[model samples]
Target chain A: MLDLSRVQKELVDCNRDKSSGVSIDLVGDQLSHLAGTISGPIGTPYEGGVFRIDIRLPDGYPFEPPKMQFVTKVWHPNISSQNGAICLDILKDQWSPALTLKTALLSLQALLSAPEPDDPQDAVVAQQYLRDYPTFLGTARYWTEAFARRVSIGTEEKVQKLVEMGFPEALVRTTLENAGGDENMALEKLCSG
Target chain B: MGWIKVITKESLLVAQREDLRNIMDLLEVSEKHARTLLIHHRWDADSLLAVFLEKERDRLFSEAGVTIAEPNVLAPLQSSQVTCNICNEDVSADAVTTMDCGHGFCNNCWTEHFIVKINDGQSRRIRCMFYKCNTICDEAIVRNLVSAKHPDLAERFDRFLLESYIEDNHKVKWCPSVPHCGNAIRVDGDGYCEVECSCGLQFCFSCSAEAHSPCSCLMWELWVKKCRDESETVNWITVNTKPCPRCLKPVEKNGGCNHVRCICGQDFCWLCGCAADQHHARSSCGSYKEEREKKTGQAKRDLFRYMHYYNRYKAHTDSLKLESKLKKAIQDMETISDSKEFSIKDFSWLTNGLYRLFRSRRVLSYSYPFAFYMFGDDLFKDEMTPEERELKQHLFEDLQQQLGANVEKLSHFIEESFDEFLQVDRIMGIRMQVINLSALIDNLCKKMYEFIENDLLGRLERVTHNIAPYESKGVERASELSDSWDSDDSLSMKTCNVDSYLQWDSSANGAGSSESGSPTDDSFDQSSSLDESGCSSRKRAKKEALDDPPFNLNLPAEGFDKN
Candidate 1:
């Protein structure tokens, strides 16, 4: 079983430092699934964007490392822009149980500032980062601005959009919230239902 | 050649203890600490010692996460209560466990952590629970705490630790027997030799494949894969068939003009594999095109070359399988001869000759592949000049032919039922032929190996390929390490006992006398005479017996005919 108490303590500990711009919240009632947000490191291509990460604590948590991936796509060499997978060593075989969720998020924040191009999850981005630094930076910044930054269209606009798609207003509101305020994905969920 | 030692399940601990004792004595450390060091160095004592010499002792220990701290440093406070960082629980000093790394956690939490690490296959190096602490928890403590709660996991931990000696060490390997014979082989020297496990399976220690002496492991691997796959058949098909232009199905032209129509009603040219139209229907596709002719000619030549080697290799391999049936027939003939009150009581020569045929046939089959790689442009093209390669190929093929001819003669003689012959002289004559042919084939095999080792592969400098040296008697059966090595007394005496035990085991297994190529009576006498000696001379005698088959071919024919 997951060390729920340790995860609980980690959540409380991470939330205590909200000013650090990294926080984790439970995705569901279960402590096993969580969502975290980390502000991009300053003076990097991803600056001013808040990247959301999906975190899952396996049954052997603390012993086995938690599985974490980006939910909001940000272009980086060591992260897959297509699926938001990460290729950090500490997230893999080098993980120490002593390291917490907050430290892992901080490592991601550091990875954004200093991308290891040699060991890459995105070969195209890594090649771009290596061969043309300016173009890579511009593309990364564009991706961060387009995907990582959350747009404030107001709640009324989202409700009105879904209502126009002929979804019940209550269902639209909950599905919109569940989809994390992504309008196209909310439409997909509504259409699937 | 390297000495291959077969380590059975019963001798695993005894086998590991030799290394463990060496490290412990050298470092002046406890057994657990030495094991930690060995595990960290992957059970290589020489490398561990090299690191010890290169680095400071404290650094060596600390780098491997081995902490031999002063007891006072890890001693608990006078206060009765201590808090374990893992569980965040308060426990009395008695309920807490302090590791060598000086990190203390409640016994419950430590036990849980050990269980998790052990189950996760990290039993060999379970680190301290404290965050970022590089110290590995002392194994003795892990065992003691974990065994208190779960004995099975502790047993698993111990097995993993024991197996790490073989699994981690480069010089040792488990006998790759299916259903697992519970034995591992350790090579004390070069690992390229062949060894017969105590379970009676012979394999190359390096590749774990069947013994393929005179063929390097790479050659043997490629040859086996080539034989297993339908690559030759595919090549033949590619050379023979042309795809229909419309259906794209392969169409084989039996004996017709270039303009052949497929069964799918698609007409195609066989020569160029292009669609045929009404405009040049008189087989104009057969007109010579340099590029197409060159490509087709090359493909045909390659296919023919492969077929030549494959056919010969397959022929010998098929004969080996067929000759195996001779064993049952020979056994039946032995029974018939035994009941007939024949003059000759011993017919081990027939069985021995049959065995020689099987061995030589295998050598013959593998020799084709060896020749394929040696003389061909695939591997040794740049290693030798054309003339040098031609001369060496002829020398090798001459030896191959001599061995092949004698092997066939031996096979023919062994298949003869001289028991049906009423004349004693004829049976004795057949016996002489069988025995002489066996010895001749054995010598030929040895000579071929010499040619391969010294003349063929030996001349190459850029590529290093070592084959298992030819053993005329057979693949050497690996003897078990003596049980007395486990005890702490009389090392020389134990070594002597292990030698005698191996001889006794070989004799019991029936390979000793038969492989030595001596009549059963001579081996019985030699073994009995060696039994009287106390120590070192027996090993020397055993080694001599293993090197040469002690057959007295000069004995008069009347001596055997009088029976």
Candidate 2:
């Protein structure tokens, strides 16, 4: 079984530190499924982007590493472009029970900054990264702009959008703030509520 | 000679125990640590020793995930309680167990880690649960913790550890039997040799295919694939058919002139395989292209050359299949001769010749494929000049032809109705001929092997092809691995079922050309023995003749004189 108490503890502890720029929240009521978000490291092609990761804890959680895949698309040599499959060692054979969802998300942020072109999940991206550095940099920055950047829509607009979808305005504002300014999350919370 | 031993499931422990014991004794380590070291080295003791001697003790131990904990570093926690980072729980210190690496985790977390790794088929090297700590967890702990919750998985873990000897070792290979026999064969030395398993499946140890010696594993592999593929049939099609210009389908001319109509209703000239209406007469179609003819000529010659060898190989193979039925006929003859009042009541020569025929027929068939690759431009084109290839081919083929002719003669004599012979001298004459021929075939087969190994393949410059040396007896049947048999004893031992006479025959005639005289001379000596002992001699000779054994020959040792 998933260590529900531990996962719950991890969520609370991770959310307590907002400065870490990595947070985990329950995707549904089940502790096994969660959504993690990591702000890209500064001075990298992926800077200013908040990448969402989908985390699913196997039954052997704490013993087995949680399966993490990209939810917000980002261009890098080690993350698949066609499917948001991240090829990180910590997610595979190198995984240890000592790691948690927060550390895994931080590792993803590190992977974004330092893309391993030699051991790549995306061959085309890796080839460009090795052969033409400028093109790889431009493509990664463009992908961050196109896909990973957080919506800059004002809190009032998100609240208005939710309220227009038959939700109370006060609840919409709080939900948008809780979702970290993610309009889609605010809409989902409003509809579910 | 190299020996083979069958490692059945029951004897697998014994098979691996020797290697484990060696590493354990030499390294002064426990069995678990020894196993970890062996497994890390893929059960290669020599290479492990080389590494042990060359590298630092700490490095060797650390590389294999064997953590020899520093005593000072393994101090127990002062407080009775601690927080286990894995589950983020505060548990009593008694609930936690510290590994040799000095990293402690709660029992629950450790068990979960072992279960996950075991299920993932990584039970062979279940490292510590602590991150970045490469220490391998103790097997005893794993077994203890796992068996508490899941007993079957613990058993699977033990089996995986035991089977790693065969799975990881280079010298041992699983018998490639269909619906797998659950047995592996371990050769003592020379992986190039062929061996017959206890289950009676003979295979080339190097390639694990059916035993095809006199031909290297590479040649036999290519020969088998070539026979299986439709390349020859395609060659036949190319030789006999022309494609229609419209549909690009190969069209065989049933019976027609050069200008024929295809079934697709397209009229084409067969010479150049081009469309021919009314006005398209013999413009360029009649003129032959030099390049096309050369290519086609080469293909035609290759097809014919392959046919020459393939036909002989197939013929001998088919004869072997048919002659296997002769065993029952020979048995009936044995029964008839037993009831007869003839002077030549001992028909041991008949069965001996029959065994020789079977052995030689196999050698004869596989030699064709050997010659095909040896002389042909496919494998060894650069290995030899054309003149040298022809000379070596003649030398090898002469031996092959002599062996083939003698095998046919032996087969013919064994097939004859000797049981119906009324004349005593006629039966005796046939007996002498059969005995002589058997020995001659055996010697010729030995010579052919020597020639292939020493003269032909040994002289190659760049590449080496090792064929299994010929056994005068037959393909050596692998002995069962028993507790009583040690490595030293197994080295000198022949097949467990072989009689002392065979031991004498094989060992006594090792490499003395003077002692290994003509086959007729050996037969004459055996006939003299037959003349002296009479009834007892027949039983002794029959025992020597029969392939399967455990018959007591009860004669004086000096009286036994045979090849």
Candidate 3:
């Protein structure tokens, strides 16, 4: 059995260090279960949306990358699975020695800008990505409003979401920043109790 | 006596003719006497040898005297061929002709003349007595001459020459002036005077007078005794013993020896040498042999007490003289502080001897002849704090500027002393003066540093400042100003020399010395003797230096002044 608590700490820092970020958490103190959140990168069609994600650390973490998945169903070719299983090179076999939580979050923000469909973990999202990119972005936004927007920021939110999770009260008051009005989705993190 | 003979041809001819003109021309001896000699030789100048035989024959007659033996066969009959010039007798073939003069004289006569001339202390310049030839005679003439022929005349001539030298110039001892004073003194050391006649005539050594003896042994003995008796005499008691009469070894009369003999075995006649001998004189005479049985018993009693006090007094006086000599030496010796060369130990010995001599000679028995009065008000000290010192700066400056500057006041001080001096107070004579001077010098030395360091320095600085800066402008002008000031100062510095001047000293001399020595005797150092030699007379101007100074305070903090 793997203790997933280490992934919760990294997921919390991912949100604090980068605004368009992703996070992970252990599920109910159970050994192999986790929870997380993901955000849309700003200035593109996905700017007004929220995304949910989940993660789990292996027993050998820091040597092993955390397992990440999309909790909110999305049509994004980069993010895969209804449970937020994401495939990124850093998380897989291609990870470098010097990568950290903040670098991982920044990498995620870059992936939103230029997603790699050919190596998509979701074949349906990848086909739609080749056929009509605008609709895939539209569906991805809808999924963020339908799933991640309904929740409050997690108590285990990353540093930025902890701030959104009421660590700093000012970030939570702006409805315009939360386009789907999903406080729970913005605040939810692997660090949630 | 024989002599060398010398003659001029003219003089010889005149003599042969019997002109006898030598005596007539003798006013100044204008003509020098020439010398001729006749010598006996191996050469046979037959005629000269014949004259020599004639002279010898004449000598035999004169020496033996003209005795006509009744059987006088050997006596030659009178023949007027030639007379021997020296013996006034007949000259036969034996008569010798004096070589240079060719005059014939008896051989014995010529020989004796030469010997007489040589014996005279003057070995040079003797000539023969030949009538015509006044020549220095040779050895042959000397051997031929005989003096016995005219012994009476020779004795007369010697006596005349001696009398003449004495009449001209030379010293001869003179009889003491007292008719038959039976003493003679040579006018050798310091001209002859009858005053110090050693034979006890009381005549002067320089001139014949009772008063001429400036000091006498008797007076010296009395003075010495009195000096030894002085209060300070106790400090120098050991020296009071009279020295040996011969060796001057101080003799202490120890044990039963009636006569004290020095280490050299010379008996010291103490009374004769010093007053101490009077003890022996009176003690020895105390037991005069009692004449009768009546006073015999009383005489013994008288003998016991006869000279007891006198003997004691005499002994005391002797010791006192030694003590005083020691004191005088200390007083008269060149000041140890005055000279750098003297060591304290050397000074002590000298002083001790002088102390002995002083008491032995009693020159200081009188009031000390000198005293000092210092007028410097600047004697207050800087080293000693205010509570310890008394002289203040203001008062000192006032005293110097006001009182000291006035010569009249100083004259009054001197006059006051003078008036007291005129009153012959014998008991407190120069003794008082010496005591006063000792205190004065000590006090002055003590006060001088205080004066110099505390007050004099500041005052002197002011005085130096008062001197105008003259090292500027032309060197000649600066020097000329100095010269003018120096001359003016010289005029300011003078004290009057004349007897009639009723003036006060009108100047402040930095360290003025009186030129006349004793204050009593024309200002010669009126100080009492510092010597065994008669009062070590010094002029008043001769100030003794206390120690060498230009004193660097680093040298044990003592101020020294150089002589």
Fraction of the real A/B interface contacts present in each candidate?
0.31, 0.86, 0.00
lDDT of each residue in B59-176, candidate 2, tens digit only: 8899999987778776877789889988878999888888889889898899889889888998899999877889999999999989999999999999988888888889899999
Candidate 2: stretches off by over 4 Å? A155-193, B70-80, B231-304, B328-348, B377-398, B417-419, B454-456, B459-464, B484-563
Per-residue alpha-carbon lDDT of candidate 1 for residues B332-391, written as tens digits (9 for 90 to 100):
675565567657756667767777788788888889989988988877879998998889
lDDT of each: 0.78, 0.80, 0.37
Ranking of models by DockQ:
2, 1, 3
**Which portions of model 1 show Cα errors greater than 4 Å?**
A150-161, A169-193, B231-297, B322-342, B345-355, B381-388, B417-422, B485-563
- TM-score on alpha carbons, each prediction: 0.79, 0.78, 0.19
Off by over 4 Å in 3: A1-34, A81-83, A150-193, B1-563
TM-score per candidate for chain A alone:
0.90, 0.82, 0.61
Residue B362, model 2: lDDT of 95
- Report chain B TM per candidate: 0.75, 0.76, 0.19
Worst 10 residues of 2 chain B by lDDT: B550-559
lDDT of 3 by residue, B1-563 (tens): 00111112222232112111221132111111111111111111233236546676434222222122234443443454565533335666555443433444555445444444444432223443432233333322333242345545444434322222122112212234465433333232233222222233433333233321112323323434544564253323334565565554456776564456677777645444422342565654445464433323443343323233223334544644444444433434444334444222123223222222222122111111100001112222233355433454344334323322222232222223323234434313323333333223333333433443345333432232111111101011000011122453222122123221111111113122355443333222222222222332222212221111111112111222210
Ordering by TM-score: 1, 2, 3
Please give the range of 10 consecutive residues that has the lowest summed lDDT in model 2 chain A. Answer: A177-186
Where's the lowest-lDDT run of ten residues in candidate 1 chain B? B487-496
DockQ-based class of model 3: incorrect
Q: How many residue pairs clash in each candidate?
A: 0, 0, 128
Better of 2 and 3 by lDDT: 2
